[model samples]
Every structure is written in structure tokens, then in C-alpha cells.
Target: MSTVKVNDATLERINELKEKLKISKTLILEIAVGNYHSKFFKKKEDP
Candidate 1:
């Protein structure tokens, strides 16, 4: 499990992107994690 903190400005940007992309919060979070994992690990498979 992990935790993340979002400031008001960042939260607002997330909401704007969510609305523009028509994606749910859960999907957005999954995409974010996927991106982080790929960038940090430099691997397609999860650790």
C-alpha cells in the first residue's frame, strides 16, 4: 500500500484532466502508478 498527498492546485488539475478525459478517479490513479513504475523501474513488467 502507498499514500500520496495532493495540494489544492494539483487536485484542481487532476479534476480538470479527469473531466476532460472522462475517466474515473480509480482509472486515473492506476494510470499514474503505472507511469511511475515504468519510469522508475525501466521495465514493462511490475516488480
Candidate 2:
């Protein structure tokens, strides 16, 4: 639906991962975003 701009090297890495991992670019990006969110944004809640 929307777009984000990435550098040439980053795009190339993404393409390489897409082929090697046999996964869609969308999924690759989704996982990357999820990991990033967990690492930097989300806080661990104590039970």
C-alpha cells in the first residue's frame, strides 16, 4: 500500500535474503520490523 526508500546496498541484501531464505520480501520485512520492535520499542512486562 505504501513505500519506504532503502539504499542500493540494503536493497541488494534484501534481495539476496529473499532468494536464499525462499521467502517473500514482505515477510522478510515483516520479520525485520518485528525483531526491531521487540529490540528497541517494546518493554518487557513483569507478571
* Highest lDDT scorer: 1
True-structure RMSD, every candidate = 14.0, 12.4
What are the models' TM-scores? 0.40, 0.38
Candidate 2: segments with Cα more than 4 A from true spot: 1-23, 42-47
**Ten-residue stretch with the least lDDT total in model 2:** 38-47
Residue 4 in model 1: lDDT: 78
lDDT of candidate 2 over 1-47, digit per residue (tens):
65987899999999898797876766889999999888765465432
Location of the lowest summed lDDT over 10 successive residues in candidate 1: 38-47
Model 1, span 1-47: residue lDDT tens: 55877799999998899797776767899999999987888764565
Candidate 1 global CA lDDT score: 0.83
lDDT agreement with native, every candidate: 0.83, 0.81
TM-score, structure 1 vs. true? 0.40
